[model samples]
Each structure stands twice: as structure tokens, then as C-alpha cells.
Target: MSGLPPFAAPMPLDAAAPAALETTRKAPTSAWYALAVLIIATVLGSIDKVILTLLTEPIRQTLSLTDTQIGLLQGAGIVLFTGIATLPLGWLSDRYDRRVVLAACVVLWSAATAMRGTAMDYGVLFVASVGLGVGEAGLTPITNSMIPDLFPRAQRVLANAVFALSAIFGSALGALLGGTIVHLTDDLRPWLPVSMQQLEAWRLTFFVLAAAGIPVVLLVLSIRRTPRVGVPAAKPGAPAAVATGATTLRAHLREHWRTFAGLVIGVGLTSVGLSSLGTWLPIVTARTYGITPVQMGQGMGLAFLCGTVAGGLLGVGAMRYLQPRMGPAAALRLIMLCNFTAALLSTLLLFTRSANHNFMLLGLLVVPLIGSAVLLPNVLQDAAPAHLRARTIAMLTMASLPFGVVGPLVVGMLSDALKSVPNGLAVAIVATTLVGGALGAMVLRATEGPFVRLMRAAQPT
Candidate 1:
């Protein structure tokens, strides 16, 4: 309360760096407008990514896919491909006009979403998932790099929270929209032209969702270009340096390996649980309680909204209370606690007796799950230099890949192994969540000292 909130200030520039680097701020109106556009894109992208989660049952039945195959589609198919694309996209964001890169990403993912509607088999569907992953990969790095430049130090936390909440809100909106489309597909079918009506409800849902990207693309193009605030502009007519950005990035990584290691691995482990929860919670709820997808969608959507809002409030309160005492380390401690809480709540999902009970637990479960969404970016933006922000974020994403690939797949395999047991899928989800959360907590605990030290060193005098 007395000092700057954690991650509210930019990192100090390297001492060896040139003194000519000038920091420029965007106009408040332009900055807010860009954030609004980013929120829309984040929401639309999330809808496209997660609509498949809601349709898992129908897609499985149609394709004659096992739970394991569905797991691959949800996990490795999208996440592995995303991991492959993230670094290159991150590099591009650092070197080029991020607005153009972002606009192109919207188009690619939107097209990929439409392609999913035409999938006749798992192979085609898998390819579409890959496309979706590649397109969506640009979002994180670009936004992470861009947000700091848009707002000044005092407003950074507010801007970061708003951006993070957009993702949660987008996910909730996705579930609602997915549910509504599934519910209305039959009613809307009759109005379609003859050739179009033959597509299944799930197929048509993708087509409709993909159309939303058009406006998002236009919005991305409209964002005014902002200077990379901490980056030094080369003097006019100076010879271009031969050293690549990657070389400087590698040196920075070598210098700060401990902080990055803890962040990447700890967060990666936590993602395993979150990924499993996102992939299987809907399917498990439907199977356990015999609820329809429409019902599942509405319940889950409401749960996501209520839970994220509650979590956001709780997180802000906790940060305000803790930062004054513990400083920047408060964010890390909050994240660890959230993971533990999520693990405990996830285990309780196995015991819920009714659809409403299960949905209520899902809401409670998300309360803890939303912590990383806000805090992780806060930590990263504070730790990395402006020139290296996107790549630094991309490295975090890449580190999470192995864990993300394993999370859903392990749950599916476990579910298959436990198929004869009552609540087999729930049991699988519980096991993964407990392990991921416990390990993630321990890893993050180790990182606390390193992170605090890094933040102290980076603080502007």
C-alpha cells in the first residue's frame, strides 16, 4: 500500500546498453482503444480454441474416437503445434510490426476454425487443430510485449489485470456461445440453404464461431503502432549490427537462468492440471450426471464467469494485503497457494452427487485456477527487458509444452485404465490435478528467493 504495487514498474535497462534509448508513452485514449481491441481478439480466439472442448462427446461419437484420441486432439494436437510456432512468432513480434503479425494470426486461426467444420475424420480434425494452435500462438507473446508499451508504470497492474480477465471472460463467453449454438442448431438448420443443412450441429458451431474473427482482424489492423519503449533506436546511417537478437537473448537467459527455470518449470507443471481440467471437466460432468452438452455448456459458462470474477477480486485483495509486507514475492506466494487450492477442489469433483453440485464445484475450482492468469504475466513483464519481452514469454510457453502434452493424455490413459471403476474419469482428473498442483507449488516455492532477487535488481532507482 505504501510503495509501488508488485510489477508496476518497468525493469531497468542493462548498464552496458547505450544511453540513447528513449522511452515513449502512448496517448491514454489510443492505449485504452488498443486494449479494448485486444480483449475482443482474446475472446474470439479463446472461443475458437475451447469450443471443441464442449463438443468432445459428439465429436468422439461421430469419429468413433476413444477417450485417448480425444485427449490427443485436445492436448498434443493443439499444444504441441502451438509450442512449435511460438518462438518464431515471438521473434517476429520483436522485429516487425506486431499489429500486422497479429492481424495475420487472426485470419489464420479463423480460417482454421472453419476448416474444422469440414473435418471428416480424426486426421483432418487433428490438422485443423494444428492450424488453430499455430494461429493462436501469436497472441500471448505479442500481447505480453505490447501491453507494457501501451500504459505507464503506475497503470501496468490495472492494464495487466484487464488483459488477463479478458482471457477468462473470453473462455466463459466461448462456453456460453458454444452451448447456445448447440442448443439452437436444430432450430436454425431449417433456415439454411439446402447444401448447408446437412452439416452436424458441432460442425455448424465452428463455422458460426469462425465468422466472428472478421471484426477482430479489422480491429487488430486499427491499433496504432507504438514504439518499443526501452529499445535503443540506431542512429541514422549507422551500419546494421551483425549480431542477431537471439544472441543477446541467449546471453540474457544465461545471466538470469535461475529465475527463468523456476518460472518455466513451475508454471509448466501447474498447466498440466489446468489443461486436464479444461479438457475433461465438461465431458466428465456430462458422463457422470447424464447432462446434455447444452446443459453442460450453460452451467460451465456460468461457473467460469462467476469463478473468474471471484478469483480476480480475491487476487487483487490478496496482492494489496501482501505486497506491502512481502513486496514482489507476494505474487509468487499467491500463485502457489492458488495451485494448492485448485488441487484440493479438483479432487472433490470426484465426489459431487448431482449436476448442480458438480457445476458448483467447477465454479469453486476456477476460483483458485485464475490466479496464474493475472500474476504470471505481471512477473514476466517486470523481469524481461523490453527488447526481449516477447521471446521471454515465448520461452515460458515453450517450456510448458511437454507438461501440456502430457496432462490431457495422462488423464485419458488413466481414465481408460480405470474404465471399469465407478467415476473413472473423475478419478483420472483428480490424480493429475493433485500431482501437478503439488509439484508446481514446491517448484514455485523454490523460485521465490530467486524471483525476489531478480525483481530487486531490476527495480528502477
Candidate 2:
């Protein structure tokens, strides 16, 4: 905030601009550091987000809540709060310190998550879930905006890939650890404040889960913030708006309207598929295959783990192999095309009649996991200018919050709506995912030319 620099006109295009066509950069050791912190924060951020989703079954029984009520809990409370909170937090990220915003977010969400255990009634718990959304929503924008600044334009794909794949990381960690937290909390009945004799272990799980976030907050506090890029070295001729007005949210939005709109649509749709699948996959595997949650966790968790790791590798490694041989646009276009196809197939396999079918389809899903993993973050960084990174991410967060917005509860609605076939929820998952994949993929294609030029303009003097 203190080191104010004057702005310059958008520089003329040159060979350096075309080089940005292949936005690959030399490797940085700092990237691994960024990835490690991003991964851990992502893991907890996800657990906090989906912890309620995982607890839906047990919470339903304890509160004597109907499926409709549960839907509101997941969809309305979680999504609405996130949508509202992201704006201010994102604005803060762009103007203030990103690490501070991220650290505060982890702390805030974690505390809210812990409070969820103490809810006496539906309204209290619902508000707490909203608080969780507010906190979690702040996360994506702050962190994402930081990635491009940390590495060169060339490395943004892999860097973004590591950042984006945090979804799979979040799901696997939430499901895998949510089970363990519930199982371990079984013995602590007396240590709790009330006789949770009738209450479910999942309540305790939420408390323990929130407690795990403290260290992540500490880790986030350690990272350094980057200065705004694209602002040129000052000539000190006539001065411009170097005071607060230059950094206001209104100014930023007006300047970056196109990028913001694209982000809204892109992140929103992508989130619907992500949230619905993540919030309910364990249940899907459970009812569809008649497998226990533990077994479902193991199988699905492994698939996510493989897809996540492979996606990370593809983010960094694939560009090096492809961009020169095939050209930047060709490399990205091919990946996006294939990734969309993979998403379509994954949806088909996911909704079909057989467990063998779902599993086999999921096997194929890993390949496209690379798509969501690699492309999303890369594209976002490409689209945004340096100062607007966090806020834009916040806007994306707001847009995407709608994905989970009505996502989880829709599953509950389907279950009760068609009483006999409880797992009929698969219909919604298939529908939303296909819709989201298509919309988000198209936006990616539309933005490529703009980003290629931006990247070329970014090479250091």
C-alpha cells in the first residue's frame, strides 16, 4: 500500500508479446514452497467447506431434520454467505496484504467451524455454516491472485495447476479425514460439555476439524506479498491518482470489467460440478455400491489422489513438452478439448447403473482432473492484472459459490422427491456437471487470445 507508483499506458506489442504465446517459464524453487503452502491451506479450506456436507447424514438424524431442511443448510447457508463475504475480502486482498487476508480467513473459518459443534438448534447451526462459507470464500481469491506474481508467465500453467487441483486435494482430505475424525471422537463422549449421548460423533468431528486449521493460519502468515505488476517504471512527469482512489474497488471493477464477467461465469459453473460431486460422492459410492463410507473413502480418495498428482505434473511438465512442438494456442486448445471430453465421459460413468461402470469412468476421470487442475488457475492468472488478482479471485469465488449454492440440497430434494430410489440424486450431479463443464470450457477458449497478449507483455525488461 505504501510504495505508490504512477501508471503508464499499455505498452506497444512486440516480439516479447508473441513469446508470451508460449507462456512457459524457467522453474523456480520458490514454486514448491508456494505449492506446499497452497496445498495445506487448500486441504483445510476444503475440509471447512465440505465438513458440513460430510456430516449431513448424521446431522439429519440428530436434529430430526428433513431432507429439505438439510438442503437449505448446505445450499442456502453455505453458498449465500460465501457470495456476500467474497467481495470485501477480495477487495482487501487487492489493496492490502494477501498473506494477512489468507491467514485471517483460515482463522475466521476455523473458529466458525468449531462453533458449529455447539449449536443448540437449526438456526444457530445454519448461521455458523454461513460463517464458514464467508471464511472459505475469502480463500480462493487471495491465494490464486498470489500465484502468478510468485512465478513467471511461462510457469503459470503448472503453478495454477498445483493451485487448482486443490479441489481433489480438498475432497480426498475431507472425506478421508472426516471419517477418521468421526471414528476417533467416538471415545470422548464424557469430555464434551453436554451429554452428547444422543448427538452424533460428527459434531465432535467438526470441532476437531476446526481445531486443525490453526496451524495452517500460522503457515499462511509466513509468506511475503508481491507488488502489483504491469505498472511501469515512473517517469515522474504529470502525476496521476496515486492516492486511495486509484486502488478503490469501484475503479478496479470498472477497469477490469471483461475479466471479471468471464471469471464470474467460469468459476460459477465450474464450482457447481465441483461442489455437487465433492459434497455427495461418498454418499453416491455408498448407496450405489452398498459399500461402507470407509471403503468408499478409500477407493474414491485414491482416484482423487492419483488424479491430483497427475494433474500437478501435467500442469508444469506438459507445457514444456507441448508448447514449442505444437505452439501455445495449439497446446492449450488440445488440452482443453480433451479435458472437456473427459469431463463429459466422467459425468456419463458417474450417473450410470453400475458401480463397476462408475469406477471405470472415474478411472478415465483422472485424465481430465488434469483439466480442472491445470487449466483453471492458469487461465485466471492469465486473465487478471496484478493488483486485481485477489479481488477478481473473490468475484470468481462469489460466482462459484452458487455452484454449491443449491448443489447439495438438490441431492436431498431428489432423494425425498422420489422416495423409492434414494440415489436418484445422481441425475442432478450428471446434469450440473455437464452444464458447468461446457460453459467453463467455452470461456477458457474465448480468453486465450487476450491472455496470450498479456503474457507476452509480462516479460522482464
Candidate 3:
């Protein structure tokens, strides 16, 4: 409840006057430490979400579930509440101590993830999936909102890039580590009790992943609170305001409707393609090649790690190079092109009969996949006002869930129609990517003027 030290005094949310800003020689070691811990927490959350993808076949076979059901569990079932809840949760984050909101979410999701290990049927698993979504709803908004405060404006792109990498790492680790644990569980099955033996390796994998969250929660709690940067400092014992007006939200949207709507829908479309592919690629490769889940996990995990890293670094470089010659707007166009290219290449997976070729395409896909993910947020965050950052991001999160809900489910349904899961998923991914990328590009082009104006307003004279 105590106020930050004098040096850490909060500035008004609307402050644009240079005098109101804090001048620091550099962000303190504590800030960097906080960044490290946040990344670790994100990694844990991603593992919980991604392990489900690894276990799809196992869960489907065990529960007598269909691909549509698995997609629902992965997509809409999890995100329905996640999208709805984020508005309120995001408001809480903007108004309260983000550390508290973040810690609570970590504990909640971890518990929910652990519950997945105990699910007996469709109903139980559905509830657990819902719980997982509710818990995860708070993460992206809180984390992205905090990054700008933790680092300066100039460094936010780099910082956001670092944060985005955690998802990649977590996905990789979930496959690598989750697959390893599942393999181990198979070995240990003989020595286990009857109750445990009845449970599958997939179930035990969830348990292990859930247990991993404990340390992450401890890590979240261990981080000392830092003042929310660029906002007015509250009195030591006073509560921060929780309300933002509908009028304010409407007016902001009205002024920059193009940027707001375009980015949200554009990014949302992009998410459909990305999420569907991420959720289904492992299953596709496994089903197609008759490979073990463990091998697929290892292959995909290493590929993601290597590909995302290369993509991200190259993205930063591309931005710098293009911004100078083509201007920021044109540079953004280049980033979108890269995304479209990745999506276009993603279709090639279906044509290749060889696992090696598919894996190579997956790796190649990562370059543009990670590139677009990192830069798009940079553009969005730069355009949004400080006071509305969390809510704005939450809005995007809410909007994106529809894609999350439909993307995977549609792929599953399409696969069912085609009588081939692998081919159907590939067709679905390519279709979504092309549609999403084209729409995103159209909106970006239409809204460039509004986006530029907002970016200018965010700058100090």
C-alpha cells in the first residue's frame, strides 16, 4: 500500500510533456530482473496450453472424442470465457497492482491445468479447459501493458520481442519436455499403483506441467512491485480508480476506428492461421507419418526454437532497413508481406509426402511467423494511449478469440469432410492464412493515415 520511492513517482497517464517524464540513466537491474521473471512465468503458462496439443491423439482415443471436440477444447471452449473475462480483468490490471493480478492468474491457471490430469470425460475436461482460459486471459494484457513501463518507449519493440519469444520457447519446451515426461510415464507405468496405471501418459503429463507452475507463482510473488510508469502517482493509501467510461471508449474508437478495428481484425485473422497451424501441425505430422508423438515433439520443438530466433532477429533488421528507405508505414507493409509469405509456404506441407520436407517447411515458416508476431504488437502499442493500453490489448484479445474458437474447429471439421486429418488441416491452414493476410493488408492500407496520426500524438513535442 505504500507509495513508490520519490524517484519512482507515478506520472499522469496523459502526460506528454517532457518535464513530466522521468529521466533515468538506464533501467535499473530490478527492471531487467522483473522482465526475466515475467518471461519465465509466460513460459510456464504456454507449456500448460501447448501440452494439450501434444496430447490430442491420446485424449481423443481415450475419451472417444472427435477432432471437432478436441478443436473446441483447444479453441472456443478455452477462449469463450477468456475473451469475455479479459475486459474486467484488464480493467483491474490497469487500475490495480499488476503484480497481484498477474500472481492470481498464475495460481488460477496452474490449478486449472492440474485439474486436466483428473478429467474423466468430456464434461470434466471442458470445465478444466474453461478454467485454463479464464486463468490465461489475464496474461497477455498485463504483460504487454507492463513492458512499456519496465523499459522506455525506444526499447519497447525489443522488449516486446523478448516477451513474444517466451511463447515460442514455451511451445518448444512443452513439446520437448511434455513429450519427454510422457515417454517417461510410459516407462514408469508398470511400477505405478492401479489408479495411476489406469491413467494414461497424457494425463500424467498434465500433472507434471501443472506442478511446474508452482515455482513460477513463487517467482511472480517474489518480484517487488514497481510503480506503473507514465501514469499519475496515487497516494500511499489511496485506491486507484477502476472505471473507464463507455463514452471514452467509444470516442477513442471513433477517432481511430480504422487503426483500432483494422489491427484487431487483422491480427485476429493472422491468429486464426497461426493458432490452427500451431494446434494441429504436430497431430498432422504424427498421423501422416506414423511417427511417435515424442519424435514429433522433439522435431517441432527444436525447429521452433531455431526458427523463431532467426526470424525475430531478422525481423528487427528488416524493420530498420525498410523504415529508413520506405518509411515506417511501408516497413509495416514489408512485415505483413513476410507473414503472407509464411502462410503461403504453409500450404506446401500438404503436397510433400516426406516428413523431412514437412519439417523443413515448418522451420521455414517460423521465420515469417515470429517476424510478424513481434512487429504487429510494436505498431499497436505505439499507437494506443497509455491509459487505455491494457483495455485496448484486452479488446484485441477478446476479438481474437473468435479466430481461436473457429480456426482449429474449422480445420477439424474440414479434415472430417475430406476423410484425412493431415490433408484437411493443411487445406484449412492455407485457406485461413490467405484470407486473413489479404484482409489484414487491406485494413492496414485503409487505416495508415489514422495510425500515423495517433503515432504522432503519442510523441512528445
Q: What's the TM for model 3?
A: 0.90
Clashing pairs in model 3, backbone N/Cα/C closer than 3 A: 11-231, 11-232, 12-232
In model 1, the runs with Cα more than 4 Å from the true position are: 1-27, 233-247
Which of the predicted structures, 2 or 3, would earn the higher lDDT when compared with the native? 3
User: What is candidate 1's lDDT per residue for 415-459, written digit by digit as tens?
Assistant: 999999988999899889889888988998999998888888667
lDDT of 2 by residue, 86-167 (tens): 8898787765666787888888888889878888778888888888888887767766766655665556555566566776
Per-prediction TM-score, please? 0.92, 0.76, 0.90
Rank by lDDT, descending? 1, 3, 2
The runs of at least 3 residues in candidate 3 whose Cα sits more than 4 Å from the true structure, single-residue gaps closed, are: 1-24, 189-194, 241-247, 420-422
Q: How high is the CA lDDT of each candidate model?
A: 0.82, 0.63, 0.74
| 207 Cα displacement, candidate 2 (Å) | 1.3
lDDT of each residue in 28-101, candidate 3, tens digit only:
67777888998898888888887887787878788998877877887877867789779888888888888888
